[model samples]
Target: MSTSNEPVSFPAGLEGVYVCNTTLSEVEGLEGRLIFNGFNAIDLAETRTFEEVWFVLREGRLPSQSELSTFVSQVEALSHLTLDEYKLVKKLRGGEPMSAFRSSLSAVANGRGFKSWMNRDKAVVAEEIMTLCALTPEIMEVLHTGRKPKLKAGNRGYADRYLWGILGKQPAEADLRALETYLILTVDHGLNASTFSSRVTVSTGADVGAALTAAVGTLSGPLHGGAPGPVLDMFDSIASVANVSNWVAEKMAAGHLFMGFGHRVYRTDDPRSLCLKRVAERQASPRIELAKAAEAEILAALAAKQQAKALAQNVPVRTLRVNVEFWTAVVLEHVGIPRTLFSSTFCASRMIGWGEHIREQIAGNKLYRPRSYYTGSKP
Candidate 1:
């Protein structure tokens, strides 16, 4: 350790560093596991509804049946925007979906006067979370389809309503289950970029909406939530399993980055990828078939190239395998969700996580004030 009074050096990008503790979820990279609260995330994804997972992440235990029903009712009740909020949604309708969502949420936060959620009652925080969740799908649908979101009655639950609003019909059972699984799997991951952004903002005593606004902006970065659409684009460009290997090699040779392969964490497979792989398998689609074959060919080529080059074993390799985005693209496509709305779809589920972590950050209530090392010609 340096004896002098100077800032401690950290790894570039703060990789492998624990900035704060969280009870919401943990990502175990080496073992390729994710745990949400005390439950395995894979189990939760397979067995629980998005509402149930949201409750578990925030409340720290599974809700009883009555509790779940009440929570679902509460979410449904909060799903509709207020008159002014709806007007704001309408005025802000013609833009990128995420941009519209940011504006719409700001209106809700301002109208409700819901600043400083860190110090509010649990009920207030819950409302903030619910409002964000409910408003997101509507904003996305309006922006994507250029029409007001339809609130049809046959939608039985939050996920169903979300799909129905997006697709403008009663969603099939298969679609509903797949979308819910996607939401559950993406709900939280420990200290990811967006979650960290949320925590950082809330640590400064910002309102919940402000914190989530920061997170959405952070997630807008290409390195974060911007890969799913491109993954699908890559699939479209290749267009067939027989062409995947050549296409991957051509892209690699041209120094074009692969969209869905590498991850910052996860020494092994991404468990979310594994979970969504199962979801994709259940949905019969030509895209799924091409993706499965493409994944195999791509992984094999990447592995072979890595072995031939023989880089240092300790260095991080770009050979990191398929992440959640690979299968996520296929699964969402199979479920009839468009590529344009993919990142917004991710944000919709992640609102629950952002809220939970924001609450956690402020409950302990330490402002994030990390030190920095400056190297450029310091005065």
Candidate 2:
């Protein structure tokens, strides 16, 4: 650890920093690709269920038919909230939705009886993982409606349960597939901000509940999981596609974020965004056409700005493109997820990722104590 903050060199925002190695997932930024356990994420999203992908992610192998059935049944059986856990969520009402969701995680994480992260054997952690995965959607229901989630018997899959619980109605299979793709695609993506936070918290021997709640807290930031709702809202403010150029120009000139445009990595298009674009178009999402139109104008505006900057400064320009949040807003809205619940809904998928990382961190634990060089003068 460094005694000083800097005069030290590092990537601004730790942009390309590599922390720990894992057999979990990888993000190929330049190619705009995401891979989970050596499987192309898009392929998994298209062909495999979220449960299957999750099994592969945690075990490093795809499940057999019997194994998958067992996993699904276990998840379904564990989905029910106990009387006390149900009561905990009732107190979570009336805050930022994601904040309430983060608190709701404690209903399992801290409220449920589990030893510290170090003491729990792998079986207990595995159970915690399954329990949290199944429990999240039900908690979201309670958090949102201030009542138990209206879940039905024999849900088609994990996505069906979550969508049915949150929306309080049976979702169509096609809509469930769309939501499944979104969930599987987003379940994990390399060492993202929230995933890293989960690993860090668990590395310190905290329980899964504590670590996941921490992850959700990190995800609640506008810079992370909070952008999707605003992406839909951005379209509402634009009068028409013809007006998009002017709107983009005004926002850029004002030093405002373009809502759903651009990513920290991924110089090319974002793969998840592309998948959701296709899903939105196929679903005939009300916002898809406008999102496409606005995306074009935003890209052109960015190019013009970058070209001017290049001519003036002769420095290499980094490109920014559409990120997952753009079409995620559209498709999730098309599937009946409220704009406000967009970020919380993200937790439904990501809790699995957080659990996986937390388990990994605890297995070969190392305290995450990174160093920084101090820049301030000594007294």
Candidate 3:
């Protein structure tokens, strides 16, 4: 190595950067493992309800039967949006679903008196969390259907309520289970872009609403939480298995991204993709079939053209595999969710993680401050 009088360079996009330490979750990209509060996320994805996982992430352990019953009751009690909140949601309808969700959630959280939760005890903060969890799906329901969410006074887990409340009908057993698995898988994943946004906002002593609002805005960007719907769009355009090769080739030649095929962190297959693929298979919807066929065709085409070095300098591109968004779109479509509500659906589940992370950040209590390299002229 040659020495030079120059500033040292860091990884772009903060890849492999450790911003802060936490007990929230760990993303082992190479190993394709995710651990949440010491529980294997894949195990929780298969065996636990969203409420159960929420309790684990927030309280550091899974809930007992009594604890789960009480927790479900509390979450249901907090799920209903007041009349004023509904009216506010109405005013914000007809915008992009994620955009509407962000504004409407901020309005609902502030209207419910956010200051009461700010700087309060964990229970109060948890109430604020439960409020967001309860309301996010409601907001998505109204935004998608232009109707008030159907509130039911009965025992239901958070994921089940979201499905039934949004559709205004009891979801099918298979559909409900599919959605439950989706919610559990997405509840948390290390410090993603949106979670970091929340942690940063909360670190500066902001309320949960402010922190979550920051998260929602960050999540709205296409680079972060906006790929699921487009994956469905890609499926629509491809339309059949026969067209997959030509479609992949044309898009690849034109330098267009295959919406659901890549991820930032996973060098190996995204384990969530594997979990969701099984759900998609069990659901057995036409869209899932199309997505699966397209995924296989794309992979085969990539492998065949590996010697050509089509997209990268490496002999093969590991990112040319299916990611969580591909199967997420398949499963969400299988469950009858509207495409427009995809990212909001993501937020509905991810809000649990956001709330838990904000609480953890506040408990640790340090402001985030990072230095930047300056390349412009300085006075």
Index of the highest-lDDT prediction: 2
* Clash count of each predicted structure: 0, 6, 0
Candidate 2, superposed: residue stretches over 4 Å from native = 1-6, 375-379
lDDT of 3 at 86: 87
Residue lDDT tens for model 1, 1-379: 5555566677887787888988889989889999999899999999989989989987889999999999888878778766666666778776567777777777777787877865468667757767777667666666566566786775667778778888888889888999999999999988888899988998887888788888888887788877889999988899988888788888778867778887788879999999999888888767887888888877887787776566756554555699899989998988888887888889888888888887788778788898766544545
| Tens-place lDDT digits, model 2, residues 1-379 | 5665558677877777888988889888888889999899998998999999989988888999999999889888888888888888888788898888888777666767855667657788878867887888888888888887774877887888889887888998889999999999999988999999999988888777788889999998988888988888899998688888788889879877788777877889999999988999999976777888999988888877878888789887867788899989989999999999999888889999988888788778899998767788888
Determine the C-alpha RMSD for candidate 1 after optimal superposition of all C-alphas. Answer: 2.5
lDDT of 3 by residue, 1-379 (tens): 2254355587887778988888989988888888999999999999988888988997789999999989878777777777878888988988677788889888987897786344578778867877887777667777776787776555357777778767778888789989999999988999899999999998887778889999999999989878889999999899888888889898767867678876777877889999999988887788766787788877776655654664667545444567799999999988888888888889898998998888788778788998765555646
- List the candidate 3 regions with Cα displacement exceeding 4 Å: 1-8, 116-119, 153-155, 304-319
Q: Indicate which candidate wins on TM-score.
A: 2
How much is the lDDT of residue 114 in candidate 1?
74
Q: Candidate 1, residue 330: CA error in Å?
A: 0.5
TM-score of 2: 0.95
RMSD of each: 2.5, 1.9, 3.0
Positional deviation of residue 314's Cα in model 2 after best superposition, in angstroms = 0.7
**TM-score-sorted candidate list, best first:** 2, 1, 3
TM-score of each: 0.92, 0.95, 0.92
